[model samples]
Target: MAGIIGRNVNGNIAYLTALEPALPGFITNDHKFRANDGAYTEVIHTNAGLLGYVSDLGHVDFYPNGGTDMPGCDSAECDHARSYYYLGESLISGGFTGRRCATYVGAMTGNCVLWGNLNMGGLVPKTGSSGIFYLETNAAPPFSRG
Candidate 1:
């Protein structure tokens, strides 16, 4: 489920942007925001593997390397290999007076800021104020629809 998801001049796995949440010269994480109830979360990936989880509000917690058994997960006795992360709260802020993707900001501290009329990869807001969002292996169009 990892490595070489695409091919370009050579190979393309992930693309990191020079946004706030990312390190100076590296893209080391993947993110997804749930807007149904307004939640933003990300999975921390490292050279070793999935390091742990962090939220937009300012809560950080990591998992220790262990066997497949997770101790205080739930009644199902969760598996360490199969874990889930959640957002703590909404820390979205900026002078941006435009419609933001998902919850507006990157959802995590230092994360990038993507602004436009659409969320980019998911549902258009119920207010019908967003535009058609698409994600492909090509350069995005240079037009904005309201």
Candidate 2:
């Protein structure tokens, strides 16, 4: 964390942020990260694929497919490329809504209930709130389910 910069970003930041793990080069669930000093974090993950859970960082975490192993994907490269796809679509359509989860387990298990919702990535930072979120997307394009 410190090597990337002169300080620990996982410690001090204030604003909305988003993360998507496209490759093993990005990170895996085994590594834990948290913005301990009032920074809101958002993690967009495709369940537990080759690029598994990134972290339960002290921010808004989104779990797609409930962290279940996704099927029809056989290449780590393709798995790595998907985050870009989602982000590209997200920027234009501005969909990909998520439901607040009661617990991290609830997000991982796709057991999110009828809590409030938030749009994942948007032109503006999703400020003033944070929580674990769950959303479903198509395995292919038109990925934003709103």
lDDT (Cα) of model 1: 0.21
> Which stretches in model 1 have alpha-carbon errors above 4 Å?
4-10, 15-67, 74-77, 86-146
* Per-residue C-alpha lDDT of model 2 across residues 46-111, encoded as one tens digit per residue: 545455544455457777656444334466555544555666787888758888898868887778
Q: Which tens-of-lDDT digit does each residue in 6-121 have in candidate 1?
A: 22213222221101122222234333211121222112211111222222211111111121123333422232222221111111221112222243123212132345532221
Clashing pairs in 2: 41-60, 47-67
TM-score of each: 0.19, 0.70
How high is the CA lDDT of each candidate model? Answer: 0.21, 0.60
Backbone clashes in model 1, listed as residue pairs: 20-110, 21-110, 21-111, 56-107
Cα displacement (angstroms), candidate 1, residue 81, comes to 5.7
Tell me the lDDT of model 2 at 5. Answer: 25
Cα RMSDs, all models: 16.2, 4.2
How many pairs of residues collide in model 1?
Answer: 4
